[model samples]
Target: MPTQGLEKSYSREHIARQVQRLGEEISRDYAGEELLVVCVLKGAFLFFADLVRAISLPVNVDFVRVASYGPHTQTTGLVEFRKDLEMSVTGRHVLIIDDILDSGFTLEALYQKLAGRKPESLKTCVLLDKRQARQTAFEADYVGISFDSGFVVGYGLDYQESFRSLADIYLFDPAQSV
Candidate 1:
């Protein structure tokens, strides 16, 4: 349990196991389909790298850079694209991989943008689902774990651009965040 300082809740091995299971599920579901993995970059980078290799089927990986947080501790409810995908995404099976689903604003916004491209199917996968007041109706097709906590900073999640390198998932101090 996290308290004063950042503390581990799940180890790296545990995360790897969960990701392997997710890969199996994806392989089973989309066996013969055209699969394109859209990795939301910065945080999702680490998990995306691990997950794709675990899948037994052929898949293509693309990346999109989105930003909502500035120097603050919470989301600004706004998504700005730092980078976009190169693929057309027209009539192809698209799988969006995000590091976490916090308030859902960023993911929802991304989903809407991707929807405009008209894919054959759009599925979202998340590493962590932070139990908060999410404003979107969009649900994650694949979820690693759920947690009710303050801002976490590990396993690609961070605070003020730090702590993303930790292999374990951890909760940062509530008082330390803005």
Candidate 2:
């Protein structure tokens, strides 16, 4: 896809710094404990990978995929589970990692689902938190960045399955696309 309509939001260095800070914080919080890092795909894949590596703890990684925005910029208020975690979360210190906390539907739904599994402790982390767009009352325990508005793409965020491989994040304006 062309990058004609994209405006840089966050540089790769900035994102890395934030991720490292989060990792350190997480490591400190869960010191002497094992962590189950559950990644929300496919947006969180890159963030998840970097986060786990930065975290200095014994962490087991798993992935779950949910679809709320099939091919749209905004959510449809429906969350469908495409994949589930293979590892059990019971009695584990679990952390849910996601790309963005938009409408709160996807993260909240996934959080509730995992909470029902009865983990010893459950918390959430998001690369980006857009409080203005929230449709449900939900908040992430850890947030990498905050934005008032804009559909972002890059650093694993995407639009129509593109721009995810970009090194930095950008405000995507579809109307300006070539």
Per-candidate clashes come to 0, 0
lDDT of 1 by residue, 20-89 (tens): 9999999999998769999998999999999999878889899999989877778898889999999889
lDDT at position 162, candidate 2? 93
Clash count for candidate 1 is 0
- Model 2 alpha-carbon drift over 4 Å, by segment: none
Q: What is the lDDT of residue 46 in candidate 1?
A: 92
- TM-scores for all candidates: the values are 0.92, 0.98
Candidate 1 clashes between residue pairs 3 or more apart in a chain or in different chains = none
Off by more than 4 A, model 1 = 1-4, 174-178
In model 2, where is the ten-residue run with the lowest total lDDT?
Answer: 1-10
Q: Candidate 1: lDDT over CA atoms?
A: 0.86
Tell me the RMSD of model 2 versus the true structure.
Answer: 0.9
Q: Encode model 2's per-residue lDDT on 1-178: one tens digit a residue.
A: 5566689999999999999999999999999999999999999999999999999989999999998998989999999999999999999999999999989999999999999999999999999999799999999999999989989999898889999999899999877776
On a 0 to 100 scale, what is the lDDT of residue 98 in model 1? 95
